[model samples]
Target: MKSEQGDPIPLWERSEPAVRPAPSPLSRDNIVRSAIALADSEGLSAVSLRKVASSLDAGAMRLYRYLSTKDELLDLMADAVYGEIVSEGPIVGEWRDTLRTIANRIRSACREHPWFIELLGGRPHMGPNALAMLEASFAALNDSPGFDTVDASMQAIRTVNAYVIGAVQAENSDLKNSMSKADWQKVWWPYLERLIATGNFPMLAKIIRDASHPSPDIIFDTGLETVLDGLGSQISR
Candidate 1:
């Protein structure tokens, strides 16, 4: 098969080996699962072909038969997680509701696997599960009044995806450095108060004084609704 930029065709696009596996209990799924588990427990940096093989009680060379390089293995691992998003079934109800469901589900998955944000946009995700997600999303927008053409529909999907990725990244950042509300007041608020007291940034001071400190969940939902509102306007027009 032809290579792209000197790299072999992605694992998803490559044809499977013609020969069947010899008598062995190991499979590609097993290897991917083991790798995912390792990442979940010890972070993404901990995952290696040798470590995955060790978890499966198999030799590292056996894994090379399925995945030739660490990059290929990482692609497979990403696709495996995308499978979870696909299992949620197709989008339902109005276009807005469909997008909301998708965004929320992706957020949940990212939270569950903190390493997911690091892997986002790292490679093309053309595996079966990832393709299934794209197909389902396109189907949802196929009848939307605002999206009369394939390109328009895809653009709408892209808009929502961009928002979801950014929102999740922000939320994940807070989660990584999370502290209890009381703890934050004691430890960080003093420094923040000192900064606010300086007359240099009045608008920032007003916001801190006037705005309620909403939880991350509230912030995510509010931003998502605003995005849908903008999309709804186009649909209505």
Candidate 2:
């Protein structure tokens, strides 16, 4: 495949190289795996061709045979994590249930690999595994009773996906700001209390004082259900 610039397209558009006659210590899979491990442990900024190669005990230049650029490495890593998000078996039960399962899995995957969220924006992913997860979502909505057309299904997928991405991004941002629960309590909590005391933000103050703070999982589940409810209304229309 070719790009607008007429260069041979890499990443999702190209096939992996043929396996060597003799097995080698390095393969695209291992390189991507090592890079993912590094990202999971240290974050995305810490990942580089050199760093991943060092983790695999291979020279950085050797990785070029399998991956041309760090962007390609990141594409592979993101795709592999999508593979993790896929359900092990076919999604059964109602459409809402299927979508719920899919949404939760995506949220879980993002939480596990915070770096995945960083790669999620700016460009679209068309990798095999990323497409698989998307297909599952489309299929779920397509099979719904009221979602009769491809366009309707596509719109539904985008809406739910937007919610999941936005929610996870906000959740991760909050987590990053506070070093720990104790830190949040000690640092942010007082600042928030002071803001509430000013009385300019009465609604915010009310929530701060009266609302019960649920675990992140619960908050996510609640938000997911609210989004699903909105979709459910449209479907019932």
Candidate 3:
């Protein structure tokens, strides 16, 4: 297969016209999409070339037409999920607001897809869209009125990216399922209260006493606001 640069690296391994004697029958796009759907439904670990081929009603060897290996297909799938994110540029017209928009977009995309979380942690993105997304974000901060240099832009963008990724991690723990508020309290609170009542962990006890609920939404928004506030000073300076 050739890269976007037209450099021929390798081709399919199988033989025969029915298998991969000619060229790829499944386009890279089709392979990526199928992989994503399988991963989304059955989890990333459930994804295999054989599984995808079965889903497409094609021979297992047919996938070699497009992807050189399962690794290539996995990389393409990661990029495919990233491509779903739609950035708004900037809504509030401030550098911090622009950061927020980028953060929200990243969070929305990653958090919504369980497979993406696992994929990104290991794969280095070579996809055009993924590269474009990163470069575009850097440009937004660099071109903003307050942003002056690479250091400033990097710092601000890093903070925004960190919070977004943190939120995605938070979402993943709840990925399998979620419990209702009453159920959560009924199960977890009693244990927490018992620990707090013991006065063993002072900081823990203080926090538990002051906070009435374990709200993931509140944690995300509060962290988001604080991150924005910190970056605002750095950007404005």
Candidate 4:
């Protein structure tokens, strides 16, 4: 009802404003857009109705009309984040290839945002873009040879999504991830320095001495292929 600036905003707006409320000069879309920019620049912890309102020159209370709580706002934010992904490939191929493509697309979306992985599977059955992606997953299975049984198809979809979502979660983990990677590099470089210097750990040291680890993309592709291979066996039966 009331915005942080002490003005009234009804809540909800598309990317563009059709008509701006005179007093508050805000819409739901503007608030979300600004909030996204804030979150993208900062972290989700930095986002608040007050912060978004301030960015838009409105008041935080005004956001309450459409977004009752920050939780709702976050859901909206994640849904909004999903809208950014654009995957438009043919789905008529082998189910393995189809799902593989979908997983990569979703993974890349999470990778780019680095926020949606955790945002997903929370507050189930919410978020427009999230739902859309889920629907696409189910549709892919149904359109393939795995279409024999509903329960099996559902299980397969769920299993694949769990893996893809989990991959995103694993990649985006902050505290442990930072430490783990640093520790890996620490162990790797020093061990390589010594091993290469003293000629121990010959195999590992040789790979390390090659100037590049297998590379992140290579790792992702391998995991993606593994998941696809497992799925292929199920569908063929």
Candidate 5:
């Protein structure tokens, strides 16, 4: 299959250089690992072949031998993070419990590597690690009694995955705001109080006055349970 670069073979499908100079430390794994580390520190936009090569103390062009394009590098980086998700041991339990484990692992990986969802753009991942992850989720759902058909199982998996992607994206977006919670309350709380005093937003005013601000983890867990509950109702039919 073609990569985004239009290569006849995707980077993951290509064999590593069979004739690299002896004792050379440059390999596809090293290049991708270096790239991931760079992205982890500097953000995804900061990663490039030149920077990755320099990080590895290798020539910039040397990286081309491993991956011909930046998109390919991105594929490797994303899959590496997927490998982290897989590293969490086998997911075992009832269908709901199994899905909860899978969803939580995915959320943790994205939180650790914030650039992961960004890399998910419009391209489908074909990497082995990504495939394995999908396989595990599908298998879990397919084994469940109510998910009797492949289409039913696939729909359930997609719903859970979409919830995770959207939820993590919201969390990451909130994190982008640099203001500390104390600063936010000290500065904006007064202004928000004035807005609430207007009595135009009764529900919002009530929330501001009464709702306990839950932690992100609590919000995520609550939302996941709701999603699973909805799915459970659908499947029980």
Candidate 6:
């Protein structure tokens, strides 16, 4: 019943809080949705139970009646974003294609909510929506002969998830540092050229002289294709 912090287990793992009928207009879903909106616009640091309650025109005590802590609210926010990854209909295609679609969707989601990678870094999210995403991924590979056991399928899923998360984090960092291809060439190219002139790194000098700078999108697609290709080879073997 106790968490590592010596407090009671979080709200997500606990039974729902009791509410009097027709007592308040706020619901857990409303609170979570409002929190997600705040996060989407202002970033995750801006999200707090007080701010969420204020946005909903409710009291912080009202939110506590549902979600016990800000961590639980973050769990809910992460799961809500996962809910957006649902397919309108059944995913149709080979396992590779299905996985590719899912991976790209994850990357897009991360781009949309730059804070998602940070929220997801600490622990596994097993909320309903998060579980549903895992279920869908398992379903995609269920019929694949390469994944004969649950372990194989799960390994493949983890590999794809790891790649997607890392790729998005790198992309987000580049954006934060203003190091896009154009930005890099604009701001750092002069210093880079001088470094190249020193001839300390011949390969880097050659790259600077001959190679075009890659945009984040280009880097992401190239890395994704490489990962998918490696996964395909494993499945075939």
Instruction: Mark the regions of model 4 whose C-alpha exceeds 4 Å error after superposition.
Output: 1-20, 86-92, 173-212
185 in model 3: Cα distance from truth in Å?
Answer: 4.5
Which window of ten consecutive residues has the lowest lDDT sum in model 2?
15-24
lDDT scores in order: 0.82, 0.82, 0.71, 0.69, 0.84, 0.81
Candidate 2, 108-196: lDDT as tens digits: 88988998988875587878988888887777667678778998777767777788888899999988875877866897888888887
Best by lDDT: 5
Q: Which pairs of residues have clashing backbones in candidate 4?
A: 2-61, 2-62, 3-59, 3-62, 4-59, 4-60, 4-61, 5-59, 13-29
Q: What is the TM-score of each candidate against the true structure?
A: 0.86, 0.85, 0.78, 0.72, 0.91, 0.85
The alpha-carbon root-mean-square deviation between model 1 and the true structure, to one decimal in Å, is 3.4
Models, CA RMSD each: 3.4, 3.2, 4.7, 6.7, 2.9, 3.7
What is the Å distance of residue 28 in model 1 from its true position? 0.6
Off by over 4 Å in 5: 1-7, 19-24
Assess the local accuracy of residue 179 in candidate 4 as a C-alpha lDDT between 0 and 100.
Answer: 62
Model 6 pairs whose backbones collide = none
Better of 1 and 3 by lDDT: 1
Q: How accurate is candidate 3 locally (lDDT)?
A: 0.71
Candidates in descending lDDT order: 5, 1, 2, 6, 3, 4
Off by over 4 Å in 2: 1-24, 179-201
Model 3 TM-score, 2 decimals: 0.78
Better of 3 and 6 by TM-score: 6
Clashing pairs in 5: none
Q: Candidate 4 or 5, higher lDDT? A: 5
Residues 99-165, model 1: lDDT tens digits: 8988888888888787777787556577888888889888987886677889977777888888988
Question: Residue by residue across 1-237, what tens digits does model 6's lDDT show?
Answer: 567789877455776566555545777888988988898898899999999989977778888778777888889888888888764445547778877878888888888788888876579887888888888888888887687888988888888888888888888887777755686688988998888889798999888679986888888888888988998898777
